[model samples]
Target chain A: MAGIFKVKAKAKDGVTKVKMLAKHVMETGQRKDKKTGEIIPAKFIQEITVQHAGNTVFSGQLGTAMSKNPYFSFTFTGGAKGEELSISWTENTGASATETAKIK
Target chain B: MTMHRRTVVKAMLACGALVGLGAVIPGAAFAARNKDAFSSDDQAKAMQALFDAEPANSQDIVLKAPSIAENGAVVPVTVSTEMTGVESISIFVADNPTPLVAEFMIPAGTKASVATRIRMGKTSTITAVVKADGKLFSTARETKVTIGGCGG
Candidate 1:
């Protein structure tokens, strides 16, 4: 469904470049609200992985130090046109989602 | 949290029943078992928890970052290496409360290059550690932060 993640992937000369942007608050649990002065609970993407043809291309384990709305780019070999890259992520709060994109 | 657990169970059932399980990679393959590493705060201990080894400084590992960052909330960092058989690439901000920022696993066919954004509390030395062929190599660069990102 492409929810929470936007991806652009293209393959050329046996190399595929994939770039994605994820919508996340990435609260570090250190920031305090101006009005209430209450500390925000820590919440962020703990793990993210991308796979093609049943093989993992890239995987990341993140911390609260990552910026909000995380963006990432990497390249892998052997992907082809019209193939789908499956992305899945799990956050610290236990929420997770899986999405797919077609390689151009 | 009861409602959340029920929803998760429902989703698991749906995923197990309908999908062919072809491309559905198991979470264990790249699971987040480094919660302690993420919260270690100390760079040396965090590195030990993450890689379980002391990284040897290497010039082959290239870490690119701004010499001066205008905003600490979002600083772009890139790590690349010419080394082959790269296992993973990890980012560390020495002065952050939690020094370890992120760790990326590079599969066999993937290139040893990664780019992402991170948060910095203030000016600090950022390091990129790469594990290749069962050995760790590292490089570091100093980034001057104009504004602190983490308000403590």
Candidate 2:
């Protein structure tokens, strides 16, 4: 599924706050294909991790029960004014996507 | 004359026995009503593995969601807990194919708050699981999905 994710970050007193939204189908494998009448294999983002300056800040395990296009917001402890925050997700089927944001 | 009185007493005893059995064996009375969600053994096992314990009743957790969801594809849900020493927060949809919906890890010294949108296949109870200081606590609210937005 093609979708968009937005991340907004702000720095105050050396702390950086971040929020993210990602688009995905998150099929639970229980739903059947309309034409084939076969169950669709479960496909979802199994894991999501966020790192700031190579330090793991947040991570989560996701399941097929999540809605399409999940959105998450969180805060990290430290960041400079222009440092890069790396975000990535790995789907159960091996598909992965990553994005980077600069502290503002 | 005495035999008729004895027969009536025996019938009353039988009725009392049936009522007692129904009360003791929960399955006998509400098996049909239990079909709202979580019917399969495998699904139950999966839900169990995600959390240390089954969802329990709680008064401190507040779950916010629309009483009637217009869209099943995306139903917004917000959960907040007043319980102290919280470790994690999770959400589950009883009517979905997989009841274990989402889990959040709340690091120590952070506020225990989570808000998200979930997909509902139909009318179901939305559960919030809170793990506080190694013990599991939970609360639930019923949400009615008016339209079958999960590809009905």
What TM-score would you report for chain A in candidate 2?
A: 0.84
Q: What's the distance in Å from true for residue A34, model 2?
A: 3.1
lDDT of each: 0.91, 0.72
Model 1 DockQ class? medium
Q: Which structure among the candidates has the greatest lDDT?
A: 1
Q: Mind giving the per-residue lDDT tens digits that candidate 1 earns over B1-152?
A: 99999999999998877653522333235444675577787999899978878999999988989999999999999999999999999999999999999999999999999999999999999999999999999999999999988884
Best prediction by DockQ: 1
Model 1 misplaced regions, further than 4 Å: B1-32
